[model samples]
Structures are given as C-alpha cells and as structure tokens.
Target: MKNNWQLYVLILPAVIYFIVFNYFPLYGIQIAFKDYKAASGIAGSAWVGLKHFENFFNAYYFKRLLSNTLLLNVFNLLWSFPIPLILAIFLNQIKSPKRKRFIQTSIYVPYFISTVVLAGMLYIFLSPTSGIFNIMRTSLGMKAVDYMSEAAAFRTIYIISGVWQTAGWGTILYMASLAGVDTSLYEAAEIDGASIWQKIRYIDLPSLVSVAMMVFILDCGKLLSSNTDKALVMQTAGNIPTSDIIGVYVYNVGLGSGQFSYTAAIGLFVNLINFILIMSVNKLSKKVTDVGLF
Candidate 1:
C-alpha cells in the first residue's frame, strides 16, 4: 500500500464520488417502502410495505408504461447496436489516417449534442407548418404531417434520432478493439488472397465478439429505462399513448405531484427488473459464448 500511495491517492476522488453520490443515496431507498412524508423524513416515515408497488401494479397505465418502455429500448437496441460495429469496421478499412480521422470526427459530433437541444432540434425540424420536412413534402405535392405528435411514429423517431446521435460515439470501443488486431493477421489474409469482406468476416468480427457481448450485456440492463428528460421534452398530447414511459411517469407523479414514495417504489421496481435482466443475460452469455462482464 505504501509503495502505491500515489496511485491510491489518484483514485481517492473516484472512490469518494461513488461513496457520496451512489452509496449514500441507497440509504433513502427505504422510502420506497415508507409513506415518505416531508415532515417525517426518510427514517421517520411510516412504513407501508409494498403499498406503492401494489398501487402501481393496479394502475391503469401500468401495462402501457411497461410495454412502451420495453419496446422502445428493444427497438433502440436492435437498431443502434449494429450501426456502430459496421461503422467501426468500415472505418478500420480506411487506410488513410487523415480521411479516417475526419470521418470519425464528423460522425462523433452529434453525440456531443445535449438531449434537450436535440429534442428542440427535432421539434423545429419536424414542425408541421414551418419545418423543412413539411416544406419538402409540400414541394413534392404531399400532405404535411406532424411527426413528433404522431404516436405511430414516436418509437421510430426516437430510435432513429438516438442512433444518429450515438452510433458514431459508440464506435470508439469497437474501433479500439479493432486497432489492437495484429497487423500480421491482415498480411497473412492478403497473402492467402482473402477479400476485404472475407477478412472482415474471418478476422474483425471474431475479434469483436468479447467486446460485443459485454456491450450487449450492458445494454440489456437498460431495457426498462429511457432517458427521461429527452422523452419528456419530446412527449406531446397526441403521442402520449406511445411516449408515456415509466421514467416520465415517475418524474411527473413523483416530483410534480409530490408522490415521492410512490415514485420511489416505481424506480425500485424498474431497477430490480433491470438487475434481473442483466444477470440473466450475463449468465446466458457466459454459458453460450464463454464471454461476459463478470
């Protein structure tokens, strides 16, 4: 310990951060089982074990919220997971460093945009009256449609926008994995008269297996969660049928309506489900592919 004192000192901030922000907040999780009065505080709150969970289970919007949250994430995972892999593969094949760097930078720029700003951009670009899309449709002799308000289009828009924003940034890990590939392997493939597609299939994809599995396992853990702020901002009266997810519900009824205990219960329930899902996925992945986060 004395030999690595500087190393430990460097890590102290991260340790303290987790302790203060992550571990300390766990103390308040008991509120999920309590009535959680503001005057009573967390420890003083009246215990009402499972009451909030039961109420939420019986709520009319329960099924819709669960389905919406699950479907949105499932669709997002399906769409967003592969684009980055493909981009990384294609980027790896780019031999010119300058061209590759420029493309990589261009693609990564969108990920830096804030969720609220992206949502506002969506609103502006999809505005039924003055939006460019509507204008283009009108020019092409088509009816203008309010995409943001269309419940049928909600998931598609969400998934597409999320992919656009994140796919490039997501390539970082895969690109790193690819960068570590032995140059000799490519040389050997070339000597064997292997084509680019064949080389990618035989070399690149296989090398990415472990990393991909870890990424998939992590993504599965978020199956029941969504970005609340983005969804909340994008939500509209017409799209509530599809856009009303558990996070938004928790935000509204928990903070807005002052039902802290109720929302905490919902949050706990979602966390438990996510935990079960991630564990199940990790176990199955380890069993089948011999690669997992564990």
Candidate 2:
C-alpha cells in the first residue's frame, strides 16, 4: 500500500469529483419530502411526506408523460440501437483504410453538433415553405408538409436524427472489439473460402455479444428519460401531444413554474425508476448471457 501511494494520488481527483458533484448534492433530496420554500429554505421547510408524489401520480398529465417518455425512448432504442452495430461490422470489412477513415469521420462529425444546433437545423431543413425537403416534395407534385409541427412525426424525426448524430460515435466500442480479433481468424476463414457475411456472422457478431449486452443494459436505465434539450427546442403547439415528455414537463414545471418540491419529488421518482431498471436489466443480462456491467 505504501509503495502504491502514487497510484492512489492519481485516483484522488476522480474520487473527489464523485464526492463533490455526485454525492454532495444528495443532501438536497430531502426537499422532495418537504414543502420547500425559497424563504423557508430546505432546512426550515415543513415536511409533507408523500404528498408531492401522490399529486404527481394523480395529475392529469401523469399517464401522458409516462407514455410519451417510454414510447419515445423505446422507439429510439429499437431504431437506433442496431445501426452502429451494422455499421461497425461492415466497416470492419472495408479493406481501404482511406475510405474507412473518411466514412468514420463523416458520420462522427454530426455527434459533435450541439443539441440546440441540431434542433435548429431540423427546423430549417423541415420548414414547410422554404426547406429543401418540402421543396423536393412540392417539385414532385405533392403538397408540402410541416413535419416539425406534426405530432405523429415527432418520434420518427427524433429517432432518425438521433441515429444520424450518434450512431457512428456509438460504433467506437464495437470497432475496438472488432480490432482486437486475431488476424489469424480472418486468415483461416479466407482459406476456408468463407464469404464476408459468414465471417461477420460467425466471428464479428459473436465477439460483440458481451459489449452489446452491456450497452443494452445501460440503455434500459434511460427508458424514462428523453433528450430534454432536443425535445424542448423542437416542440411546437401542434406537436405538444407527443412532445410533452416527462423531462420537458419537469423542466417546465420545475423552473418555469417554480414548483420546487413537486418537481424534486418527480425527479427522485424518476431516478429511482432508472436505478431499478438498470439493476434489473444488469441481473437479467448476467443470467441470460453472462455479461453485465457490474
């Protein structure tokens, strides 16, 4: 232990980071059970026990929020989850280093775009009057559609844009796993006259099983959380039916309406839900595939 003091020194900053930023803020969680007031402050606030939680559960928007959040995340996962894996597999087959790097760079660039910028681009490109998408449709003898304002289109747009932005970045870990595959395996497969698809199915897909399970388990933790920034900016009066997700509702009610205690209770509820989800998924993954984040 004494000889490894320098190693401990290197980890001190990360330890302190979790302590300060993650653990310290837990003290405010008590506000969820109290009738918090700015004048009374957290310590002086009167305890309300489960009143806020009950109110949230019975609220008119309760079902809508829960459904919207779940549906959005579930659909997003269904559509976006497989693209990166497919991309990584095919990318591994690319023999031209130059072409692989170029394609990788092109796809990865969108991930660096800020949420706000991406939302703005969506609005510009989907504009019914001037947007290129609508322009092409109109040129083809079809009426223009205001896609951003269409409630039914919200999830589709969100999921598609999300994939375009982050699919390449998500491929990083899969690519790393593929990179570690022994060249001898490929040599043996080629000598056996195996096709690319056969090599990918038998070699690449099997190698990705553990990593894919971990990613899936982690994603399940966010089943009730949506990208509030993107959803908020893209929201319109017409799309409110589908776009009023729990995260946006929380932000609006919490900061916009200053319902501190109520929002705190909601946040705590969501955190508990996510925690349970992650734990359950991890256990299930372990039982089924012997791969888990823990």
- Candidate 1 error regions (>4 Å): none
Model 1 C-alpha lDDT versus the unseen true structure: 0.96
Highest TM-score model number: 1
Q: What is the C-alpha lDDT of each candidate?
A: 0.96, 0.95
Kindly give the number of clashing pairs for every candidate: 0, 0
- TM values, all candidates: 0.99, 0.98
TM-score, structure 1 vs. true: 0.99
Clashing pairs in 2: none
The sequence of per-residue lDDT tens digits that candidate 2 reaches over residues 1-294 is: 699999999999999999999999999999999999999989999999999999999999999999999999999999788899999998999999999999999989999999999999999999999999999999999999999999999999999999999999999999999999999999999999999899999899999999999999989999988899999999999999999999999999999999999999999999899999999999999999999998
Model 1: how far is 46 from its true place, Å? 0.6
